[model samples]
Target chain A: GAGVSQSPRYKVAKRGQDVALRCDPISGHVSLFWYQQALGQGPEFLTYFQNEAQLDKSGLPSDRFFAERPEGSVSTLKIQRTQQEDSAVYLCASSLVPVGRDGYTFGSGTRLTVV
Target chain B: SQQGEEDPQALSIQEGENATMNCSYKTSINNLQWYRQNSGRGLVHLILIRSNEREKHSGRLRVTLDTSKKSSSLLITASRAADTASYFCATVPGDAGNMLTFGGGTRLMVKP
Candidate 1:
């Protein structure tokens, strides 16, 4: 892909419903990251992956939030029994390098609205 | 918790003027990065400055970092209406590997 791609640009889910957001990072990128951006706020880190390995899950808000990168190319963020507080934009980014020397490429994001 | 914080939650300026946004972070960092986000869109990487470097430049953007003060600033010269967007500062905490912690961000509005 030319850039990071995210699915379901917008989503509306009931309070208890489950939602899955997908991300297709730039081809051959080795690192992936997921973030949640609340209204009028900056994106907050959710999780990080180095290829197929889930190196960090410390930022996941709760057990309800689960992310997987089984193939190391595509990733998904799943939120179970979504709550009102889950209403926000879910962003996915990928980096070419494992460290901070190179910047990341971001997806347009999935805007989830929990009512 | 967010590791960085940007001041001047909102900034308004006219085209051709210079806009400056400041960011402060807690704890040691490997590097600092700036990003821009237009309304309802994803962020675009602007510039990055490593801890060892005090300043960096890219086109109309100039970034300065002061590790001693744990702060960084982004200066956009001759701003344009196209530059109107929210600017954020993200840090790679020395202890946090590749995960980046972002600040609240500063919203800049450049009127043409």
Candidate 2:
């Protein structure tokens, strides 16, 4: 792909429902990251992956939140029992390297709404 | 937790004017980067400055980094209406890691 791609540009889920968001990063990108952004705020780090390895999951809000990049090319973020506070945009980004030397290319994001 | 804080929550300027946004961060950082986001869209990387570098420029954008003070600034020269967007600053910690912590961001509106 020419750029990072995300699925389900918009999602509406009832409280307690589960939702999954997908990200297809730019080809050959070695690093993938997930972020959550609330309205009027900057993106917050959720998780990070170096290829198929989940190096950092410290940012995940709870155990219910899970992310996996099985093939190191595409990734998914699944949230279980969504809460009202979960209403926000979920962003996916990828970096050619480790992001220290290069900035990330981001997806438009999936706006998840929990009512 | 957010590592950086952008000053001036909102800025309004006429098209042809220069717009500047400031960002301050806590703790040491390996690099600082700026991004632009149009309403309802993803962020686009603008520029990145390493801790060892004092300043960098790309096209109409100029970014300055002061590691001693833990601050950075983004200046847009001859802004256009199309330049209106929210600007954010993100930092990668000095420690080896890929996660980038972002600031609250500054919303810039360029009126034609």
Q: Using TM-score, give the best candidate's number.
A: 2
Q: What TM-scores result for chain A when each predicted structure is judged separately against the true chain A?
A: 0.98, 0.98
lDDT (tens digit, per residue) of candidate 1 on A1-115 = 8999999999999999999999999999999999999999999889999999999899899999999999899999999999999999999999999866689999999999999
- Over B43-112, each residue of candidate 2 has an lDDT whose tens digit, in order, gives 9999999999999999999999999899999999999999999999999999877799999999999999
- Candidate 1 accuracy as TM-score: 0.98
Model 2: pairs clashing at backbone N, Cα or C within 3 Å = none
Give the 10-residue window scoring lowest on summed lDDT in candidate 2 chain B: B92-101
What DockQ values do the models have? 0.78, 0.84
Chain B TM-score of candidate number 1: 0.97
Worst 10-residue lDDT window for candidate 1 chain B reads: B92-101
Q: Please give, for residues B1-112, the per-residue lDDT of candidate 1 as tens digits.
A: 8889998999999999999999999989999999999999999999889999999999999999999999999999999999999999999978658788899999999999
What is the DockQ (computed on Cα atoms) for candidate 1?
0.78
